[model samples]
Target: MINVNQITHHFVLGKKGNKTIVPVLKNISFQVNQGEIVTIVGRSGSGKSTLLNLISGFIHPTEGEIIIQDKKVSEFNETEFADFRLQHMGFIFQNFQLIPSMTAFQNIELPLILKGMSENARRKTTADMLKKVGLEDFGEHYPSELSGGQQQRVSIARALVLEPPLILADEPTGSLDSETEQDLLQFIRELNRDLGVTFLIITHDDEVARIGDRTIALADGKIVESGVFA
Candidate 1:
């Protein structure tokens, strides 16, 4: 479903007069099949999130290619990338990037509205997602009003409401208590099993990585180990 080939990324920092190139990823290559859950485990600076951004088209690699299905996203311009992301990818951030001002339902409905779906369809879909994530009664709540776990569920619901083919989750359980984290993982597993949503999860927890169909460990911007857990 996704292919990243020899991708290298570096960022230019400081003014043009005093620039520095900070390398992030180096010659990375991998493939994720449809309906598979692949976890990327790494320390804070190991470029796991950078790799996810590259694959999801949030950022382009300094060199090489990123292909989703058959389309080479590396070549897509900003507008094209935005369109492609909306159509094909759902992103779940560690910080639960929900809008503080929008109600949970509205936050989930925004994507469908942007896609020009009718109000009735958007409402139905968003409602169903809220239920799926166990947030049915909290639709009217704002982000600040919900507990951390509830907020994260809202984030997950917003990501999946559009039914995108792939879900890119970065540190999805980073802020939750152990029990909450377990619940979220189980929910994610159910999503993968029943909905067949492909997941590329970036996490620092080995236990989290084990939940995937396979795990890829990264260090200093490169893959050090990749295989199915025993």
Candidate 2:
């Protein structure tokens, strides 16, 4: 469903004349098939996050092309990518990334609202999402009012409310306790199994990596290994 073809990314440090180019990702190529959970695992400074950002269109790749669902997204400008993202991609971040002032219901409904869905339709969709995430009763609660697990569930609901085909998650279980991490992983599996949603997850934990159908390991900005998880 997604392809990263020979992409290279670097950061220019210092002023123009004295700038030093520090490469973050070098010659990275991979593919994520529809309905598969592919996890990218790497240590700090491995450029895993950079790869995710590039794929998410938060940042353009310095080189190479990114095709998603057959669209050459790498060539899209910010406005185009923003619209495409809302219609095709979902995101789950480690910190939940919820608006503390907005109630869970409002947070989940935001995407639908942005899509210009009628209030009645958005309300129904958001409510259904909250139920799917097991947060039906917590809909009125704000981010600060919920536990870490509950907040993450709300984040998942918000991401899935639009029913995007692909979900890109960065360190999804990073902030949770072991039990909560396992719970969230199982929930992710369920979402993939029941909804046929494809996942591309970035994680450093082995336990987290084990849940993937395949794992790609990166080191020094290169893919050192890619294989089915044993």
Candidate 3:
């Protein structure tokens, strides 16, 4: 589970010598329960991605506390955050962030490689994940050789291969067509249901938000609305 309390973030933008503070998130607070799918919906500049970044430990909040599984991570330095992310969080991006030169199998295997998992273990795990994502036959193909949906499948497989407890997806469906988007969302839902992996997804799409167990609406860096959809 993840808990964010009274978090605020801002950045300095301007010349090197002269900078102006631009706020991104304003007193944002939320909690994600175990085995639940929570969506943060917002338009551009609404700070949805900033909130996700804060949660994922990509960037710490300027002020406030971020507690994951009972540990306060808001004060963690970059090195600590990097270790935490590898151990606890899986990330999916709108761009599918796959390595261009790696084949599907290799791409999915990268995390395990980084973790120093045994070659045999990585092979078995990566192959099983490929099958789980319905990419069993395409592991040998490079990203350039696959369709958009297939490439995203590879990306999803990579994200899940490590079996991290939490997945932080940012605009996961932005690059897909409507049909593919639905399929991908349904796959995510099934993954949540079957694996009990908690998900916190950030997106601007209402349809995407509707797929979650609960939706938190954000605007102007604040939570405007939040509720579980029946």
lDDT of candidates 1 onward, in order:
0.92, 0.95, 0.91
Ranking by lDDT: 2, 1, 3
Report the lDDT tens digits of candidate 1 across residue range 152-220.
Answer: 999999889889989999999988889999999999999999999999999987778989999988899
| Residue-level lDDT tens digits of model 3 in 53-145 | 888887878999999988799988898888888888899899999999999999999999988999999999999999998999999999999
- Superposing every Cα of model 1 onto the true structure, what RMSD results? 1.0
Residue lDDT tens for model 2, 1-230 = 99999999999899978999999999999999999999999999999999999999999999999999999999999999999999999999999999999999999999999999999999999999999989999999999999999999999999999999999999999989999999999999998999999999999999989989999999999999999766
Worst 10 residues of 2 by lDDT: 221-230
- Best lDDT among the predictions, by candidate number: 2
Which residue pairs in candidate 3 collide?
Answer: none
**Number of the top-ranking candidate, with TM-score as the measure:** 2
Clashes of each: 0, 0, 0
Q: In candidate 3, which residue ranges exceed 4 Å CA deviation? A: none
Error in Å for residue 1 of model 3: 0.6
Kindly report which residue pairs in candidate 2 clash with one another: none
2 or 3: which has the higher TM-score?
Answer: 2
Q: After superposition, how far is residue 78 of candidate 1 from its true place, in Å?
A: 1.1
